[model samples]
Target: MPPQQALAIARAFLPKRPWGNRYDYYYTRAKLRTDPLYPGVLAALRDTPGPVLDLGCGLGLLAHALHVDGQPRAYYGVDIDASKIERARQIARRTGLKDARFEVVDLGARWPEHTGNVAILDMLQYLPSQVQAGMLAHVSRMLAPGNKLVIRSALGDDSGRGRTSKVTDLMAHFAGWMQEVPKSYPTRESLEGHLANAGLSATFSPLYGNTPFNNWLIVAERRAG
Candidate 1:
């Protein structure tokens, strides 16, 4: 199915807010339509035959898209934002997407116990440097052979595109949308090193789409010993 159709179906699961909080709906549509990350995520999970544990999942948008696309993998999404979790739960309840679950979770304190495909999308930058490594370590241990961990994050480069992403993140933080200010972004090499330390092989790709953000997707898979 084309991404547009999948996105349309996903939006159908969300409540209509033509007047109140309309920005969320508009943002959702624009994101699902323009951001390459959503399609990239679906492709990453296509062959991974297990439940998806999404860390820092915002509004469980990916879960909705998966459900719309008829992917049968059960989904468990965790985020630190209570409001987003509530919104996700409401969508699930309204749409009757029983396979999807969302919860308010502090990833720094405790990681959920699950094994399968994992996703950390546009979220790692919000974590402190130490917590980011620890979280990566925990996720690595959770995966067995054939399990993949997909991460989409902006790269830290001293370039114009890098600055663009950084500025956007800062604005988001200032607007109170992001709970914590982004402390740092990892270089591709550094991220790969982290994946290697976790016993995973990484495949990196530019996922900026038509945007100027220095975003990349790292699909790290644990191989059989």
Candidate 2:
């Protein structure tokens, strides 16, 4: 790997330093090299024709990469921590990225206000249940029908009555910060329902094994005009 990429890979696994608060530090790093699905992420964003809003964007690496490819006209990252935002700013400046921007805001405190393309990577679970649904519904209102939402979240397995539910709940309880992730554990039926409820038609990609936890990538398009 090249020097910067090498640094990013090295930094990816560093025990979280005490510099920034928890989410900011981790999310920032995730934006850099933590996301192993960058090929898919790049493919999803490459064709988007509007300004991209990376909700809960940590260090802005995803957005920065998109900008370097000369794809998005503008890429904006909003996070709940200012320390991470400062770190993101530094990354932008060092890379000489101009079309990207970062904002300090707790999106869970309120729905993010942005139109066109959107990305919420492993951030849905961070919001309370109602907030997760509300954010999707809110985005439903903001984005046109042709727009897409790429969501990466944990799946809860609610297969057979009490047994699965208990297991799912146990997973959530132990997931800590990851608890917000739906404990369904990547079942198509459950994920499809979430998309259907949000007024989207969805297709899913199963990403499992060799990763920290089970995850599903939902690529959904708004169903109503």
lDDT of 2 by residue, 1-225 (tens): 133653553353334455644554355444444444554666776665777778877667676556545565677888876876887877676566777889988776876688887787766656666666667777666565566687766665433433443454467558753323332233456557656787887778755434545566777777755
The regions of model 2 sitting more than 4 angstroms off are 1-34, 158-191
TM-score of each: 0.92, 0.70
lDDT per prediction?
0.83, 0.63
- Over the full model, what C-alpha lDDT does candidate 1 score relative to the true structure? 0.83
Looking at model 2, report the run of 10 residues with the lowest lDDT sum.
177-186
Task: Name the lDDT of candidate 2.
Answer: 0.63
Sequence-dependent TM-score of model 2: 0.70
lDDT of 1 by residue, 62-123 (tens): 88778766688789999989988988888777777888898889886888888788999999
In model 1, where do residues sit more than 4 Å from their true spots?
1-18
Best by TM-score: 1
